[model samples]
Target: MPLVRIDLNQGRTAAQLREIADAVQEVMLDVFAAPPGDRYQIVTEHPAGQVIAEGSGLGIERSDALVMIQVFHQGRSVEQKTRAYAGLSRILAERAGLAPGDLIVSMVENTKEDWSFAGGRAQFLTGEL
Candidate 1:
């Protein structure tokens, strides 16, 4: 399971936020092969001054529409991660009207033992996943 956190400048409507979240989930499903209903996402909107996103020498210009996505999950193959990035960029552009440059994504990998979905047990290790 992947837990995603979406951070953006505070402005868009709830529907727009929902669309962004849904698009991310779709990418996870397609690229990561995450099961349906395994969605774990959080959307946080920050004030203009509170959110600062720069290109970091990439020569890319970002706007207030910046979206930062952080995904925490088990390690994935480089190919899978690349595909997810492409899918996210494409889907966000089509569904949320976000430019590719306005998006930033990062992933944190952990072992299956790092997660305890319920009963204070590691579901994956227990073969309950």
Candidate 2:
């Protein structure tokens, strides 16, 4: 499973936030090949000034509608990640009316040994996942 964190400035309603989160989850499913119904996400909306997203000199415009996504998961290839980023940009724009220019994404990888679903056991190692 990929755990996704979506950080954006505070202006959207709860339904809108869920739409953004769902958009991220869609990328996890389609591009990252995560299993269905394995969604895990944290959507945090900061006050307008709290989220400072710069254009990174790429000239991509930043806005309060900026969406920063960090995905934590295991063993996805570079190609998968590349597609995931593209998919997020496209899907978020389609589903949430978010500008592709206003999106930023990052991924972090870990091993199965690093995850414990419950009971202090590594579910992947224990064949419980």
lDDT of each: 0.92, 0.86
Candidate 2: list runs displaced more than 4 Å: none
| Alpha-carbon deviation at 97 in model 1, angstroms | 0.4
lDDT, candidate 2, 27-79, per-residue tens: 89988888888788988889878878887788888877888888899989999
What is the clash count of model 2? 0
> What CA RMSD would you report for each candidate?
0.9, 1.0
CA lDDT of 13 in candidate 1? 97
The count of backbone overlaps in candidate 1 is 0
- Weakest 10 consecutive residues, lDDT, candidate 2? 47-56
Q: Find the 10 residues in a row with the least total lDDT in model 1.
A: 47-56
Candidate 2 accuracy as TM-score: 0.95
Number of colliding residue pairs in each model: 0, 0
- Indicate the residue-level lDDT of 70 in model 1: 95
Question: Highest lDDT among the candidates is held by which one?
Answer: 1
Expressed as tens digits, the lDDT of each residue in 1-129 for candidate 1 is 799999999999999999999999999998999988888999999998777887889899899999999999896899999999999999999999999789999999998889887799898999989
TM-score of each: 0.96, 0.95
